[model samples]
Target: MDAEIGYLTPGRTRRRSIARTIFAGSIGNTVEWFDWTIYTVFAIYFSNQFFPSQDTTVALLATFSVFAIGFFMRPLGGWLIGTFSDRHGRRSALTLSILLMAVPSLVIALLPTYSQIGVFAPILLVLARMTQGLSVGGEYGAATTFLTESAPAKRRGFYGSFLFLSIALGLLIASGIAWVLTNNLNRTQMELFGWRIPFLIGGLASLIGLWLRRNVDETQAYKDMANKGEIPKRSLRWIWRHHRPAVLRLIGTSVLPAFSFYLFVSYLPIYAIQRGGATPEVAFRASTVSIAIFMCALPFFGRFSDRFGRKPQLIAFACAYLFFLYPVVNSVGSGFWSVLLVECFGLLAYGLYASIAPAMMAELFNTEVRAVGIGAFYNVVIALLGGTTPYLMAWLQSINLESWFLVYVCAGAAISLYSFIEMPETRGKTLD
Candidate 1:
């Protein structure tokens, strides 16, 4: 193998540069998730501010409907920006996507409330969400692909795992900020203005991410593709013709990670508040600690996968699915420490899947369709499974069938695990 061009190398200097690339890529993920989750964490307070209907559930539903709209735009964003990433360069695509996210997140942070502008408030909220959805839709696949492609082969799992460690950190940042702000304010102060603080904070984090991203180089794979004049004339078209199996496989494999990630990271706060009958402070604390524990372990699991192979890690995770998923979710409201323990356990098990799946899945497709094929399909599942998990859980809980939510997630995980068996083991394989 060519020492410099191959995924693995024995060079100390190259390892450090790979570290820098992963760090830069991880920041955008952090900022994107933080920007996204801040909206969810603060939804209870801000939903009424932007959308006031006679029934509170209806108003909250409308607010989350805007959230779902963001999800709807994600597939389109994934297809568009992902094609750009394939044709252009990964670093540039990532930088551009973060900027797209920053603008609307800042706008949402500072926008006027429904009380101030009537129906326009919700309209503007929907517009901002659409922008956010578009940004994230593009951000995930581009950023993760860059990080994975740039990392040293032996440590690809370790480095790639940071993508979600940073994501977990991002959620911790949102929940921590929301917890402090909500705790600081009198009820009126929080309702009036304090709720905006998290978005403001997200804008600042995004700006930092933008700055760091500026320093990273394009991936070698992309540079080679570009130099050969092999950038697909039609990235999307090539995806359908050549990579349909890879895409469908990703969609099924996506179900577990998407469901687990959203349930643990996105919806947990709401569940804690609404279903678990906990205060914001308690829920935020639980999420922070639980996710932090998981983040710490991400690199280890990822590095382990690099040695053991992708399929084995996913299979192992699947085998243990029954023991972890439902037990933890059902137990989250049991109390602070117990809920924390259970949620952290779930995240820990999820690490086996989330830590290595990005690189594993991306490697399955050819470079021509790599971007749109991976991004569009991967995000589409998230838009469905991840975006709707909470809403569906809420509905189930409303009907006194809350435990069934666990079964749904478990079933999804099982489907994903089954799909994993059919995937080729891509431990040290070359990416075309």
Candidate 2:
């Protein structure tokens, strides 16, 4: 561990740089999630454009399958770019991830429909989603490490909370936009042109993400390790030799958050429509409202974690889910209020886990391999569980066993609960 990792003399100039770094790091997170989620938000509309299926459920399953394909690319992205970040620099990796995301958004925006290009349309859509997946695979690890390392040691949890703050905001904004589009456009309009609007907006927004990230400074921790010539030549080998325990903890801790986030947050709108028989507008509106509350609640949990401890909050939340998830999930019915209430309750429960994760994950590995370790561990879990969750839930429901989906998510939470029980408290620990 390097002694010089978090040193900073108090000054206005330095404070401003920290603010800029936080903004630069977090804004791209917003864009990355926005671009990623817009596909899910609009999947009901756009699925028909690419997948020419007579069965509506088949078409949606096809679209989500493409969404899952993008997720499969995440591990590769995490490994390659995370290794590059370990070898090169976080700033470079961060910038490259945002740029990679922008191109896919633009491609989806301009993509020809199956009506025009037939078989080629779905292929191009899958390719674009795969690229976006690659970008996000690297983005979360780089941005989380950057934000956590950039903050003052005691407040790392508070600052790191912004990663999910941005994610919640992104999903909130996407839901809002989707709601507006659904309300204004009829089914025909939405299927034909409305879906493209959000993708184009996301593409244009990526340029701003590129600009902000370019201006922010790199972390002192990474620079200190690099300057001292302590960075290992083979980062994966270093992890295997020294931090394999952390890797297991990472997987154990990562599964529930990844799985539940997709199930409760990303999949909520669709769930409302399919299981609850709500309208598209109602579902999107419910998500927008619930996510707004979720976004507002995150920093409070984060700051609380900074004061109390991450492990306690994580365990408490997991226990809450273990006890309440089945009841709450079963209570959901075909109404706007039921869907909205369930979504809010679920996100609030999730905030307890999401708020503390960035700091906890950063604290697990030393600076030498933090980015790659986080990128690989986190993305692999997300690829396997998070990406497949929506499809899994949909399939379960189709098979007349949707209750199994609830059980699956609860099982994931239980896994995380056990991991958190065994994990050490990293509160007030300096990023070294």
Candidate 3:
């Protein structure tokens, strides 16, 4: 590992440079997440377009199954793109990931319905989602490494929080658009065409993200590794051989965050509409409000982690979910206010982990392997747990055994709490 340097020392790296880096890193992330979130948010409208099933639940199941299938490609994305980032540079990899996401999003926007093209419609949708899965799989690691490495050591937590801040922004934009479309268009109109608008918007916005990412400087950490000729042989076998424990630690730390994140941010709104008796508009409105609040709270928690410690906040998050998630989820009612309140509480707890997760995870590996290390294992966990959350919830709900899903989440929280307790504190730690 290269020794920590004064590359980001106060006088050397100006505030403006850091601000631009944060914006560049965050904007692309926002676009990536926007595309991902819109798929779920708009799935209800479009599920029948591709699946053509009589049973609404069956169509949704098929849609969400495709969602999980997309996740199957994430680990490969993480490995390939992560290695590319580690070898080429964060900026290049980020730009490539956005390009990957942009094309597939546009494809989804213009895709023909099952009635127009028969079984090919669903097949095309699956292929598009798989490609998007690849893009986002790579996006998280490269962007997280870029932001965390670019920040001053002491402020890594605060800066890292922007990742989820961007994510919240993306979710808010998606939910707001859904609200507008649902309000303005009739159900038939939405089912027929309105769902494609957000995908179209996502595809176009990605170009802006690409431009911003292309203009940003490569992270100094990567530059330093290059200058020192310390770039390691990029291989999954090598990473597994040397960084095995770190990989396991990351997976353990990620389980609860992965499950709870998808549960709160993506699936819960659907649950509210389907089971909690809230209307679609009410669910979207509540989601929009709660995400806005979650976005606002991320930086505060990030800053707090810098002051207190990452472990403390992460522990609190796990403990809260472990003990309170069942009750909180159960208490959700049909009202907009009830949904909003439950979402806000859950997301705030998640913010504690989201704020500093990038910094904490990046600190676990040396510069040579940081991006790939995180990309490989973190995404695998996300693919396995996070990507499956919505499907599992829907499946459980279908079986009238939804409460069992809560048990699964609590188990994940228990694992994460143990991981947090055992993991070393990373506050203010310089990245390897």
Model 1 regions lying over 4 Å from their true place: 1-16, 235-237, 266-284, 323-337
lDDT per residue, candidate 2, 1-432, as tens digits? 243444444465678877788789889989989999899879998898898888988999899888878888988888778888878888998999999999999999999999999899998998899899889999988888888888888888889888999988887778779868888999999988899999999999998899888887788888998899766665566687789899999999887888777677667777677777888778867777887888899889999998988988899888878889889877777778998899888888889988878999999988878888999878888888877776677688788887888788889888989999999999989878
List per-prediction Cα lDDT, in the order shown: 0.80, 0.86, 0.88
Which ten residues in a row are the worst by lDDT in model 3? 1-10
Mind giving the per-residue lDDT tens digits that candidate 1 earns over 49-80? 88887887887888878888888899888888
Q: How accurate is candidate 2 locally (lDDT)?
A: 0.86
Per residue, candidate 3 scores C-alpha lDDT tens digits across 379-422 of 88887787777667768989988878888989999999999999
**By summed lDDT, which 10 consecutive residues of candidate 1 come out lowest?**
3-12
Q: Model 3 misses residue 322 by how many Å? A: 1.9
Error of 1 at 342 (Å): 1.9
lDDT of 3 at 398: 90
The residue-level lDDT of candidate 1 at 9 comes to 53
- The 10-residue segment with the lowest total lDDT in model 2: 1-10
